[model samples]
Structures are given as C-alpha cells and as structure tokens.
Target: MARDPNEPMPDGSGCALQEPFALQVLGADMEPEFPDKCVVIIEPTEFCRSGMYVFAEVEGVRWFRQYLRDEQGRERLVALNDIFPAIELNGLDWKVLGVIIQRNIRRKIKTYEYADGPSNQPHGSINAVDITAS
Candidate 1:
C-alpha cells in the first residue's frame, strides 16, 4: 500500500514517529474481550509479552490480536474469536506498534465510590454512586 509522505509510516521505516493513540475495535475478530466500538489505549513503546494484546501490522495491514508463540516456537497472531484463523508469522513482515494497556467500554454512566474500608459498606452491597438514576 502506498503511504503518504507527510504522515508517519507505522512500519517504523520512516523517521517520523507516532505517539500513544486510541483505536476503536471493529469486527468480531477480537470479540468478547474487545467488543465492537470498545476504545483501546495504544502505547507505541509499551513492551509486548507473549500473551498481551497488541496492535500489529502485517503485510501492510493493521490488526488487533493477541501475540502468542506456536508449538514450533514461531510467533503468531491469535484472534480471540475462534472463527477467525490465526496468522502464522513465519514469512510475514510484521511490527508491533504498541501494547493495549486499557479499554473503555461505553456504558450508560461511569460510576465510582470511595470508602474508608470494607467495614464502611453494607454486606453484599456496593458503595458505588447510582448517578444513572434521574
């Protein structure tokens, strides 16, 4: 694929570098864990482990998948959804752009609560604010 000279290439072949950015998940390739429209935080310099979620570029195409090693000790990309076939990376030119640190699943309302300790809350009751109620 042709890349714009002004825009930085994700392959790291160009001098331009990219910073941390947000990418919205699409399709069922990474369903359940990374549902559709869920925003993922990508840190360009984050270290990627064997089982960590990563943003990788393969064959000039970008994808969100789990990084894993195959039985033959070869690196491969596995989709959370079993329906999608895993990509064996024996001959592909791939680059790990970043590791996904966090994800924001959109819900009705975001809530949180603070308490002194576990004793401050009632048994089997959550201390979180119910601001969703109007």
Candidate 2:
C-alpha cells in the first residue's frame, strides 16, 4: 500500500490511520446513485480508473461519480443512474477517492438460517470471513 506524502506517526495515543474524504452530493448530478453524504475513502497513489467511483475535484467543487474512459483513454466522470449531468475532460486535477466497495442501506436482507447455520446458506452468509472467527 502507498503511504501518504504527509502523514504523522501513530503512537499509542492515536494515529491518523486512513485518509477519508467527505463529499456533499448535489442535484441529479449523481442521482439515481451516489447520494449526498457519500463518504469516500481515498488511499495514497490510487489513481483514477474508468467506470469506477472517484471523488473528482473540479473548480472549487468536488463530485462523486463513475469515471468513464474514452477511446483515447481520456476520461469523463459520469453517473450511471443519472444522465442530465455529465462530466467531461476528466484529466483535470481531480482528487480520486477510493472506489466505493459497498453501499449503505436501511433495508434488511432476509435469509432462512442464521449466518452460522450453513456454509452455502444465504441467511448466514458472511463477507470477508475472519481467520480468527473461523
């Protein structure tokens, strides 16, 4: 993993571990998805990739959307769920936050068995199983 150019040492007291950036989503800009207050994670040396979520800083505003690459490898950050707003010329000085690995929702998923019931059961499915937990 790449470390940030400027980061203080972490002691028992505490450490500024991961770099997190907060973005205030606006207007159908990224609607249908990437709602407002979508906290994005930005890791050091993590460049932008087409069709990936990135926190792009343009002018004085920051935007979160799925980045798209053109034939020439040029990029345009676009929202999959929205089309009214389109981002163009994606090579500008944009701060790329880490890709959105998951989403936050209030809905609960129903399953037949508890998570530990079966290995192939859906109810008790576990993501990123811990070595210690197993």
Candidate 3:
C-alpha cells in the first residue's frame, strides 16, 4: 500500500507543522539547478503560483519539481533535468506542499523570489551569494 501524501513524514525533529523547513535534495532529477545533497529551505504556503520550485504531492508520492501552469490552464510538475519526464497534473490528485525559497550549495546560498503575478520564466528572479565568510 502507498503512503498518504497528505500525512506529514516523521523526522523526529519536533518542528512545527506549518513552519518553514529545510530538506536535502536526494537525486539529480532537479539537477544543474538543485544538485544532489543540496539543502533547500521550504516556505509553507497555501498560495503557490507558476514558475516556482515547489515541494508537492502527486498520486500519493511526494515530489520536488518546478510547477508550471500554461496559458491553457494545464498544470505540470517538471524536472529541471530533461532525463525525467514531466508529470502532467490534469486529473491527478495533487497538492503543493511548499515553495522552495532558498538553496544552499557548498556554502553558496541562492535565493528564489517570485513576482507578485504569473510568470513565464521557470524560476523567478534569483540572487546568489556566497556565505562562506563569517
């Protein structure tokens, strides 16, 4: 049997259910952008727009992908790497868990901020900064 995606996974950290959290990228599915083992900060929100790197649940499986909503109103979860096929979300049971706001790659922090309205870009304005210095 598959686990219910709505139910939160236990981390034993005792973090608040609705608070922001960090997750380590486990695969190259989102590679070139979010490389394997990179840490990402997720901001829990009920409002998720297009062009955001989002943590979502689809068909009982949790996924981290770029959320896309086309002009025809079709929705999809796309991997940054082309090796993975995009997940079309027309009739599937899916929900956005949160939007990735920051990514840490070897002490370099890349911040992602979405515009107030819809966007055609895959990722909105990004600002990268090195935090290696104290």
Q: Write down the TM-score of every candidate.
A: 0.64, 0.50, 0.79
Specify the highest-lDDT model's number.
Answer: 3
Q: Residue 31 in model 2: shift from native, Å? A: 3.7
Order the numbered candidates by lDDT, best leading.
3, 1, 2
What would you estimate as the lDDT of candidate 3?
A: 0.84
- lDDT by candidate, in order shown: 0.68, 0.48, 0.84
Spell out the clash pairs found in candidate 3: none
Instruction: State the lDDT of candidate 3 residue by residue for 1-134, as single tens digits.
Output: 98788997886334586788999999999999899999999998756877788999998899999888888999998999999999999999998889998999888887777766754444543344555556
The candidate 3 region of ten consecutive residues with least summed lDDT is 119-128
After aligning candidate 3 to the native by TM-score, how far in Å is the CA of 47 from where it should be? 2.3
Task: Give candidate 1's root-mean-square deviation (CA, Å).
Answer: 10.5
Q: TM-score order of candidates, best first?
A: 3, 1, 2
Candidate 2: tens digits of C-alpha lDDT, residues 65-132: 66666557676767656555667765566655454443432322211111232344221233421122
Clashing pairs in 1: none
lDDT of 1 by residue, 1-134 (tens): 87678985566554335566778888888887678887777777535556667899999999888877544788888898899998998888888888776666764332322223234221212233334445
TM-score of 2: 0.50
